[model samples]
Target chain A: MSRFPAARLAGVAALALLGFLLPRLLGGSAHVYDTLTTIAIFSAMSYGLDIILSDLGEISLAHTAFFATGAYAAAILVVNYGESAWVGLAGAVIAALALALVLGLITLRTREFAFSLVTYAAAVVCMNIAANWDFLGGSDGIVGIPPLALTLGRFSFVAGRPAQFWPVAYLLLLFVLYVVARFRRSRLGQAALMVHMNPRLAAMCGLDANQVRLHVFLVSAPISALAGWLYAFQRAYVGTDLFDTYFLVLMLTGVILAGRRLLLGPLFGTALLLGQKNFASLGAYGDALVLGTVLVGVLCLCPRGLASLWRRRAIPGPEAPSLPGGPVSG
Target chain B: MNVAQQFANGIIIGHAYALVAVGWTLLLGAARLVNFGHGQMYMMGAFVAWWLMSATGLPYAAAVPLAVLVGALLGALMQRLFLRLTLSQDLVNLMIATLGFGQILQGAAGLAFGAKPERLTSPLQAITLGGARVSCSAQDVLLVGATIVVFLGLHWVLRRSRFGAAVRMVAEDPPLAALYGLRVAPVYLAIFAFEGAAVAFAATLVAPRTPILTSIGFEQVVMTFVVVVLGGIGSVGGSYVAGLLLGLYTAFFSALVSPAYTTASVFALLIVVMVVRPGKLAASGGFAR
Candidate 1:
């Protein structure tokens, strides 16, 4: 265990390379490109929630709001201001961070149900505002967002089609994964884990629980928002529909189905979900049923998630502190 | 904008809110559990009553009790499914499970009832109170009267009954209650079942005021959150008073400002309350404390 295990790392890298090429290898159809691009985008969106649920040990129903904030920010900038993808991306990040700061502060002192409900309320309010406020395009939303334009000195790319959008989506997913991986190893990440696992210890170690929560939220929101930024370019339209509960349920299902804390769990989970929705074709209602069932089944039957099913001695003991309504006073 | 009219509107809306929120208040009071599927349950109740009235030629009043029965069954089923989590006191998972149930209910309702909204017509809606000065329908009057009855009944049951004592004991500490051999499981089940019945009753009364849609579940009960949270989590009487206050706030805010942004404004008010009274919120759920 102490050794570098270079061969294992190489094998994992090779597998990732094969995954990256598999879509291209299989006929490269338009449907495949669109489907895969969606998986990538949705998976990226889920990672923002992954950190909050897994590391911070908090459920944030407002990530949908952040996702919308990103999509709207990008669309408004690109469509109204005639800005490029870079500016849209920046605008998306800024919008998400601002919203997160406010939400995080509002919920800093809340726990469990209160925190979740507050976040849910915030998301609902965001939807209400986006739907009613004309400046944000009201219910019509910002439409006809231009194709993504990214220019790094001489290097340039314009992705107007789903096929052309694949690399961009793939790259965004990779960047988000990298960010998440780094986050798990960062000081804040460790602090968050401590705070979640043992608040007493976290306090004894001189960490402010609320501050850590706020910081993590600030970081997590942009990850989802960036996904929304790319999604706006792909769809060429951003509407209040971005605030739909479908995305919220999907994000939750993705994060939990494949297990929490695993770097590629959300990616795998999103791929599996989109694969079912795309290929299997359960009508809207059926798909919702499937998503809902998966969330409930996993949480009820295997709280550690499906990943635990593969391992021996995988059942998490009930001795672990329960977050919902356990003895934890606050 | 007659002041009396607005006040009348506030009372009607306030009663509706309190009735809708009462089940949740009881559930929270008994267990620290939350049903994200609550609004969907309300939707289900309305649809069931509407279906009964339409399909079986049942009167609106007769269909309400039947709808409440179905709501009670749903609550029992949810409690059964979530019994493990409830026993373990695993709130996070329980919350998510409730969310999943809500989604399933919403999706199923959409398929069963279709996408378009349907009005739950009541005979009482035809009976108007006044000419044009500050009129309200008989349905609105029934709603206010029903809310008062429900609240008074709940208060009596909770404060003056042995079952109420058992529930409060469990709410204070399930493990301790169980240790004292108070049958914790039954208490949890009863509270959940009550939540279902109470929300359904609220639906039959309040849903008549507007069109019922499958997707309105979460949004429908958003105000319930304000009522329950502001009224002090599990406080029965507090929920009623809070509902009235929220009703007044909504009535005045929409009448004076913009109706479109009333939800947003209510949520803003909720956030302000949380910010100012974080400790108070944290201290919620402790029955005697």
Candidate 2:
């Protein structure tokens, strides 16, 4: 897919290096490391939804459930079984996939608002279960999660602080970015776009739309789960708050803010949002108000996202900037 | 178990759910617009009335109407913001925009009302009806009465009135309605305003039964979704029946099964219905029916 593979590889390496040095370049305060690590983890989480929203052309509000599933799974595995972070990662993936499969099948026959409503209800039900179920620690949540420890035979590294965690978070973010980029160019990715844009055409070409949706959903769940696995360690806790609408709104805004289908859009969007919250927060309510306003404003004023503004100005004509899969209004 | 008492409780709760979901039913039936913010709007309505009564010493009767007016204005404002998307028939963006609006309302409510839960007391709540077997507060009676009146009035207006015809026409085909000189935009605006007002009215009446908090909207919306969907996605009469059935089911389920998992059980019901009869979800024929 790349015209210049060598140059692209070099570019990726440079970006990774810069990302790793970003905290130190900002004086390497614990706060800086913390903020950047959070941005990375969250952007990775957002990417899971990014594929579904941007490429698959559907809104699954249940992504939050997949996210929460990952965190809860990791917390349960590590906290209850005294397992390693590797096992926690495996548990997170398995649990998230199990959830994604059920949700995918339940919603397979529905579309548009029906799909959205069901997914949303599922997330809410998940949250309620998390809060009320005694086996999951009830409302108190599972705390005292040991710091993330990844050990191999005769070699080990642990992340117990924000600074120490930055590398792991950054690596995860890069891995996610690479995976998303590749997925966009993959056959399933192409099929998803085709199914979204022209279902009849896709069908004529022998594509099973439901199968593609289910496959895409299965692929997306583990990505968010990976982020949650890391998050279980970052906060040293996993609570029902992981299923908050705030996170759902955040993922949607992050995916849409910088324009869909862009590899770096979610990452940049997450950075901008987290940067504001970290440095210039106006308390909880104020921050929420700001986030909500930004989401609404961006959609109302620039439905094509901020990237389109520059394109429109550069092209100057009655012709609208041609979106990749047409206007996402549908 | 006192089956009679639970039955009465179910009737009152059913009416409350129906009242809460009426605006959404109209919006969906007439305009095919989904307001994810409906729950937050309910939260705001309760808080607005509570704030008015507590802060200005206004009577509950006066506070309710004032809050309804505010909700109407908020709805109109939302319509204005969503006008472009609505015009373009961009359902996806419209849905997300409403979600953002809901978040904004929630945050603003938190800032304005504080995080602490507040009670929106009614004078009628102090008055009990019926004897020991199946007693309910006057407020509950009022809620049931108001719900019936609103549903009957809405049913009449939608089925028999000229304005109802125009709304149904718009819902059926916006372009054709506009070609026939229906003034489509005003119909949408009016539908949205009614949605806001109706939900606020529901909030004013039903919110007194529980403590009001910004966070309460989350659970409230889930119930609303159940009613709307089970009612066949926009059926005014169907929603009323669905709400009643759900209320009875909830009452008995909480009593016999587990109160903690009621929402989960209700959601499971929705999933089952979706799987068994997916076509009902896509059908919009309930507007006129």
Candidate 3:
């Protein structure tokens, strides 16, 4: 594992630098900046789900609720309470954590389809509340949100345009990528993988599977919320549309597209998805069809994901024995 | 609000809920498969029937059967796509795949039908029972009758038919059934096709009461979930009773409380059931008593 520490670090740094300059390299147009920023923010959003789906092996459909909570928290705090971006970020995390705690508790005993169904029902209920409640602006949604503004004493920076916001979005994505990478190596992360892969063995090792799930879920929610925190500023509005199944499907597709447990999978998957939507455009419905097809196709044809195709070709030996039954069993 | 009217309304809506959920009940009971796309399939069913009527001037009777056929075909296609995952019992991927299938259906319906809300008209909608006191459209009567008939027929088929025995065997243990020389794949295909057909039939019947949209399925399916879970997760008789009870609860809640929070309240009911009896959810019990 420690064989090429210096070289791997160098490669990661180079790649990060290139990702930062990708928009500029693509012509530095407003369109380019907007697309890249959207990609970054959405990628960050998908990472939250990636942790649970990849590491914890449960699909919490209510991640959309967490994402919405983050956006709504940011919007309500800044637009209504007159707070700064830092405060908004704090609010987003707290709100998402509280939601995650409740959801985690409710779903603690359930697994597989029951967990998914409960979480899905939770998201739907949240949407109903958002659409009906006046505090969240009812059906109209809270609009006219000011652009990203951060002030530290006398120093101030405001990002009102796509190009100006690119750095913050990029930095958020990088931070999320770092956290996810570290989480994959952390003790809790190992515990989560153990619980997911073999609850009986994990129990024999004196681990509480439910505790591991709750903690992983807690860790995962805020990551998505942070993305939603940035998303509120990026869109300049927070609406009920945030709760659309589109985001849920996108997150699932992103996590599953390139392959699960791969650090760059969601980021690459999101980039490809948003790239198609932003540049090689299909109208909304057409794009939806494409997204749905990709998700179904990837899971059905190659559960290991698109990356496995090349990996198989690159190393032709006795084929790896198939997984007996798991989410990403290839 | 008129109490009798609410009671009548509840009964009719209960039947609608049961009818809508019957397919899912069978799917879960027979195959232990969960379709996140069931709601979208409901949406498609309504839209197909609506289109058939409007486009071809077909009678509601003819259009509905045709829509059910289309739905059965769609179900078969989904089963074909998901056959590998289903066989492996890799339920996690199967669930997500169904969600994708739902998305594809929604997008296709939106493109084909456009965003404008359309109504699936029933001639019987004009007729009413118990004039002015607790009246319901004749269509509501049909809904109730259809629910009873469907339930009775389903009960008989599962209890008395060879196909029912095959489904139960597959549901109990797919590999074991295969080893016993049962063609597990055909059983799965048939179950999925039945799910599609039943949901479509429910859609054609129930959708006339409300404005139909590609998006209605999003919330519409929630009640079905509540019914399925509360009714014992694929028990046909239990689902019927649960649907009726939920309908009554929803009717009175909307009447006595807030209409907007009905879905929220229904979900709260589901959560309570899960917390109280989590074991019921994980177990896919027998097809009948």
Candidate 4:
């Protein structure tokens, strides 16, 4: 069962190489390129929340704020300051980091619903400011973002078409997936699990729960923001709609759809969701209904998520897998 | 900008906030449950009332009670769906479930009522207060009176009634209350139904003041949060006072500074409060008192 590290690395590389060809292998149409590129971008966005929701065992509803911050930062830099994609990416990370610091400190002591409430409020505040502040283009939002151009000394890559953009988006997704995998193996990840599953045990083990939470939050925001950075170039626009609940719900649904603790869960979930939106073509209202129903149904009927459903069937156990924090015994 | 008129307007706004928040106050304080779909439910209430009045040619007053009834039914439906989660006190899942329910409601409203904004008109909106220099609508007067009456009634019920005592007992410790022969599920269902009915009632009174939209679901409930949090979480009387103070704060802030930033400012205040004193949201003994 224990494979050599070199073999595992080769396997991962092969899979990534295959992913680069996935769009062409599927349909080879521009629509396929556009759809796959979106899936990759949104999946990257979902991974940010996946780390927090699945590993840290906390829901930061303000992930949308981070996502929006990146888009806006990238949009503003490219449109207003004529900055390169690299600078825009830097701006996104810095803005999200600053926001996470403030939010993390504010919500350090709060647990459960209080944490969610504060984060949700923070996201709404960001939206409100974005909607009103003319410097951010008010409701009109920042537009005319130039195509992403990352250049280095006589070598340059410009992503002006969906096919041209696919590699960048795919690379970003792979990078995020690598970061998430590395994070799951890191000491901070272990500490976050301890803090979530057993607070007293975590404290006794010499971990500061709040510090772990803050660190994890600080790390998580830039991941989503990076996705947004790419997304701004793809869309050529950034608006307050980036902070909408639809994105939040979509992110949450993606994280939980395939199951927690699985690295590919959110990626697969996002692909399925966006695929449905792209191919099936439900009107907006119907799409919302489907997304909401899926989220609620998963949490209610199969709390371990869809991945667990097949696992349960394969194992054929009488005693079902218990949900974390089961029933809170009195 | 007339100072007295703004002040009067602030009072009406304050009462409206309190009324809208009353159901959430009970749900949080008594049931120890959170509903993220709260704003959607309020949206549903207003739309249902609007639909009834428009389709049936019913009087605005008559449509309100019917809308409250529908709200109660919706609440019951939610309770039915979430009974398991409620029994377990799974706050996180419950919150998300409510959000899903709200999404469903929003989609349904969009399909049924369309996306366009519609005004919920009341006959009382036409009746004006005196002097024309500093005045309000009769609907505003009705809202203020209704808020006072509801608060007083809730206080009386929570403190002096047997059912309220049962609810408080459940809130303090559900398993223990169940062991002592309390029918826990029914209590939860009743509380949810009350939440729906009360918020729906608030919608009829308050929604007439503005144009209603299904999209407002996401943003409409922030003021309710400010009221609930500042009012000491589950304290009914506290929420009333908090609502008035917040209404005044928003009114003055909008009048003096800019209305666009008022929500951001209030949320900033919420962040400060969470940091400074989170003890206000403790899970016990803060109900009607």
Candidate 3 lDDT, tens digit per residue, A135-171? 9889988998898999889999999999999999999
Give the docking tier of candidate 2.
Answer: medium
Model 4, docking class: medium
Q: What does DockQ come to for candidate 2? A: 0.69
Please state the CAPRI-style docking class of candidate 1: medium
Please tell me which predicted candidate would have the highest DockQ against the true structure.
3
Model 4 interface DockQ: 0.56
RMSD of each: 2.6, 1.5, 1.3, 1.9
Cα lDDT tens digits for candidate 2, B1-289? 9999999999999999999999999888777888899999999999999999999999999999999999898888888899877876788888889999999999999899999989999999999989989899999999999999999999999889999999899889988999999898899999899989999999999999989988888778989988999998889999999999999989999999999999999999898887788877984677756
DockQ of each candidate, alpha-carbon based: 0.58, 0.69, 0.73, 0.56
Candidate order by decreasing lDDT: 3, 2, 1, 4
TM per candidate comes to 0.96, 0.98, 0.98, 0.97
Assess each prediction's global lDDT (C-alpha) against the native.
Answer: 0.88, 0.90, 0.91, 0.88
lDDT of 1 by residue, B1-289 (tens): 7888999899899999999999998887778888899999999999999989998999987999999999999999889989988888787878888999988888888777788889999999989987677899999999999999999998888878999889888888889998998888888899999999999999999998999988888687689988988888888888899999999999999999999999999998998888787765763553421
Docking class of 3: medium
TM value for model 3? 0.98
lDDT of 2 at B138: 96
Q: Which residue pairs in candidate 4 collide?
A: none
Task: Kindly report which residue stretches of model 4 are placed more than 4 angstroms away from their true locations once superposed.
Answer: A317-330
TM-score of chain A in every predicted structure: 0.93, 0.96, 0.97, 0.96
lDDT, candidate 3, at A237: 90
